[model samples]
Target: MNIQNFSVASLLAVITLSGSPLFAKEQTQAPAYEYGMPLDIAQAVRIDEPKSTVCEVGQATMTYVDTHGQIRHVTFLQQTDACAIQ
Candidate 1:
């Protein structure tokens, strides 16, 4: 058995296994051209029913169904309420 080679490999394995934040700095940096935005805030709300339509108010788009099961889409100037459905 090669004792020297076994010891050297064990030392390297220990160093690599210890967590180091500095080693991950390069991975955390965002690219130059790519920008970040709040994806949850920008998502469009869809209400499914029998009748609905699609409408575009601004950047956001909403889709829903009317009383008669007609699909409709509408955009809002401002988001009045946002609550997750249970």
Candidate 2:
């Protein structure tokens, strides 16, 4: 094959390989809670049932009152049965 054609083929191969999930690194997610970490929930209010999106699963947004009387917003994941404080 000609140099021009070879270069185009090599470019396409590189693009396809780079975009493949097999070559991509697995993303690590942070745990919901840490060991020995104290979390006191004074109150919890569910905002609504969120619609599922491409990047995010369907979850509910909740407002919470902590031990210190601070209001915090958390996303409750139904699949994991856990809440992530935002």
Candidate 3:
């Protein structure tokens, strides 16, 4: 009936239809990988399920999903030299 009431009603309707919280509308995204790691790591590392992956730069371990949908873990470099392979 009034301007204040109408504003609130309009905002509620928009939020309800969107099915997401108002805070979500201006959501901030997290870093692709854990902190204290080189920026290149995020770009080079691959993960099947980014959300499920557990990246520990200090431990040099990265978890991801395989092609078969199975979870897998890999290290940056173990015995074999990755650069040599390339």
Candidate 2 deviant stretches above 4 angstroms: 1-38, 51-57, 79-86
| Per-candidate count of clashing residue pairs (backbone under 3 Å) | 18, 0, 0
For residues 9-85, write the lDDT of model 2, one tens digit per residue: 99999989888874443333322434565667788755655544334456565566888897666555553222342
What TM-scores do the predictions have? 0.24, 0.36, 0.23
RMSD (Cα, Å) of candidate 3?
Answer: 12.3
Considering lDDT, where higher is better, how would the candidates rank from best to worst? 2, 3, 1
Model 1 lowest lDDT segment of ten: 77-86
Please state every model's RMSD to the true fold in angstroms. Answer: 16.0, 13.0, 12.3
**Lowest lDDT 10-mer window, candidate 3?**
50-59
Give residue 60's lDDT in candidate 3 (0 to 100). Answer: 42
Best by lDDT: 2
Better of 1 and 2 by TM-score: 2
Error of 1 at 35 (Å): 18
Please rank every candidate by TM-score, starting with the best: 2, 1, 3
